[model samples]
Target: MSNINPFDKCPVYETINLIFTKVKEEDAIDLFECYSDPITKSRMNNDNCGGVWDTHNIDAVTKGIKGWVQEYNDRFYIRWSINHKQINKIVGTIEIAPVPNTTRFWDGACQTGILRIDIISSLENKIVLSEILRMVSDNFYVDLDIKNIIIKATKDDGERVLALENNSFDKLENSTFPYSDYYIK
Candidate 1:
């Protein structure tokens, strides 16, 4: 298990246009808007493997926030709500955690961190997204004390793939699991 609760020091990063703050229960509307968008939902693949989530109701998002709180109890996951400070809205979310518990018996056990990102549809938000990617990459790449960091990228996410590549995250193949077809850091 992890020695320190990473959430305790959850850093609040700010850019000229955004604020990355610890997500709390008060962010229901902002989170709901983020998770309910069709494009965001489709890209996240939260329904299957990724810890990302898609919700039809604000209550579901509230529950998801609680889930993050419980994940802290398990000492495994923490999510940050990406708030646009000027607009007073949560435009997206970012989650970082130890990879979920599985693939140990056959896949080999090792310490790893997974970063999950989700944002509402904004055709002009590329710069904001890029900055967030770099910020998190810098924090997690060597600072997290984990051997590896994994990012789940869909085949069509060119911008995201490019950001990961810019941060020195190559196509990680078979560190512990067979990710020959997956991009990781």
Candidate 2:
């Protein structure tokens, strides 16, 4: 089989108010701001750190994005920077990968296109979130042949939970499952 990596090529998505582009080493500070936001931190599971997802330290954040570069090269998963088109700043990130084969789905088997949107406190709303999700689905899903995508919502994030539901995500009854909801198209 050929050995080309999925992330070897760059991807960019332009929406009405935002853009999704490749994450880079220079995005360390902006990434830190997104990951460190209290609402962002409180809205998702972050038990695993030691990467760009680490909110407390800039060095850790830098190390994290740098490592994501490596991870991209390795073709394990991919993260894209979410930038405000008008302001020209990264407000969040989205990590996409295959469901790790350990998690259960509606059919009770792991699936591809498991996703996580890590955004700053402010952008966690219906309008922006809907646009981001639409961008990903409309742009990348077919190229990747994604069967399903999932987003985990924190216990206290009622707005996000509602958004997920509105977008047709089925809530996995067992909260202990790594992600709280799943989306199939």
lDDT of candidate 1 over 67-115, digit per residue (tens): 8877765655668888877787888888776654552211235357667
**TM-scores of all candidate predictions against the true structure:** 0.79, 0.80
Candidate 2 regions off by >4 Å?
A: 1-5, 47-53, 101-110, 173-185
- Least well predicted 10-residue stretch by lDDT in candidate 2: 101-110
Estimate every model's Cα lDDT from 0 to 1. Answer: 0.68, 0.69
The count of residue-pair clashes in candidate 2 stands at 1
Cα-lDDT of candidate 1: 0.68
lDDT of 2 by residue, 33-122 (tens): 887787787665543333335458888888878877777776666788888988889898887765654432222343556677888888
By lDDT, the best candidate is 2
Q: CA shift at 69, candidate 1, in angstroms?
A: 1.3
